[model samples]
Target: MKAQLELLSKYSGTAIEEIEVLFKDNPRLQSASVLGVNIFEELKTQINKSQVLKELIVYINDNYSVGDKLAPEREVAEILGYERSTIREYYPNLKLFGYLDIQHGKSTLFKRSFEHQIIELVKL
Candidate 1:
């Protein structure tokens, strides 16, 4: 199912953070994620559960300029190659993993620390 942007929440320049990031892997998670750089963690992002996910991350970094309002889900899906539902499924897990603010209904405001960490994760 496709997503809409009418439900977006206002941004308040908040820098959200999550302190609970587990190195353990779940069966439900993509294999690439589970097979990430296990030896030198703490700064890993493991973004390759699927190509769609990898695209989603890069799409966010490329499109959402700071101070630019969040794009609607429809636009996001086009760039991420994911159905809205799929992206939603990833959000809660990502939030727990350290994605700062999930704003504009279907968008994410990546945290610097999380960005640094997840960037490493995706690269792996």
Candidate 2:
């Protein structure tokens, strides 16, 4: 467990500190140090390229779990390293991708699709 955190920490480098600050709120992540760091670090990279949503798709791929509640667009924005409005702006398209099922300010997901050809819509 510690070793996994260490490897994940390696991926964060300068970003570890930021993730640590966010970690305080998510105690379940106490031992999994690297996961949050990697998420934020990778998110920054993705947002810069306008591929933030795709990055989230990849994230759900790495952490496969259904019933994920993507709410508080602020948090989703934080994960994507973008503004909350950006998530709203592209939300319909996200729904079209089948990764997101949004309604009434709540976002539910079918993460399995992200496991394969998730963002292949652009290619098609």
Candidate 3:
């Protein structure tokens, strides 16, 4: 973990002190690392997930109209070049953000324009 942090510090052009300050500011992040999680990798994964989520939202907004039934998760995943599980994982987030209305058995429907919801998404 020390090595990973050092690599992060070097590549990110952030000093060790600044990294320590960030850890101090976010206790959960610090505790996660203490519990043996690779903090750098975890952070990288989260950043990547956020980027993918944004891409997915943009794709949906540009390609489909409100109330349109979306393709199945597998088909959407194939079209987006992501794993089916990845698309599935973001379904709840889409619903919560008012981008989609997902029903258990029925097809998912595009719920609203992404313009307003995108502001909230960036905070996530």
Candidate 4:
């Protein structure tokens, strides 16, 4: 467990002390660390540009409804055939880009405005 935390700390560029606190205090941070690492590694692999983004958009369109709750990362991963670690990598991006809004300890809410923006960006 210590080693995993250490790796997560290093991967996230966070101090070990801070990560320890997060491990105990905030489960989200732990999930974030693993997700961050997956995203970093995925970017490194040089897969086709926009592929993940496009796929994510499609997934969002297919699964989410405005004002509806999103499933947990584990369930989404099962549905998408992706690893939970990999699926999490996109969650924050969706939020950051205004595609989704997360409510702590509650399901994420879809933001419909992002649908068009994501489609436009993916086209380029």
> lDDT of candidate 1?
0.46
Over 51-89, each residue of candidate 3 has an lDDT whose tens digit, in order, gives: 767667767877899989999999989988999998899
TM-scores of all candidate predictions against the true structure? 0.45, 0.44, 0.54, 0.51
Candidate topping lDDT: 3
The lowest-lDDT stretch of 10 consecutive residues in candidate 3 is: 35-44
lDDT of each: 0.46, 0.56, 0.71, 0.68
Best by TM-score: 3
Candidate 4 is scored at a TM of 0.51
Q: Per-residue alpha-carbon lDDT of model 1 for 1-124, expressed as tens digits?
A: 0011111111212222111122124323323333233312432333544555565666666655544444665667766667888766655554555544675544456653334545555655
For residue 48, model 3's alpha carbon misses the true position, in angstroms, by: 8.3
Task: Sort every candidate by TM-score, greatest first.
Answer: 3, 4, 1, 2
Q: Write the per-residue lDDT of candidate 2 for residues 3-80, one digit (tens) a residue.
A: 544555576463545555655577577555555455545534543555655665555555546666654667767876
**Model 4, span 60-81: residue lDDT tens:** 7776677777778798788778
* Candidate 2 residue 33 C-alpha distance from true site, Å: 43
* Candidate 4 residue pairs in clash (backbone atoms < 3 Å): none
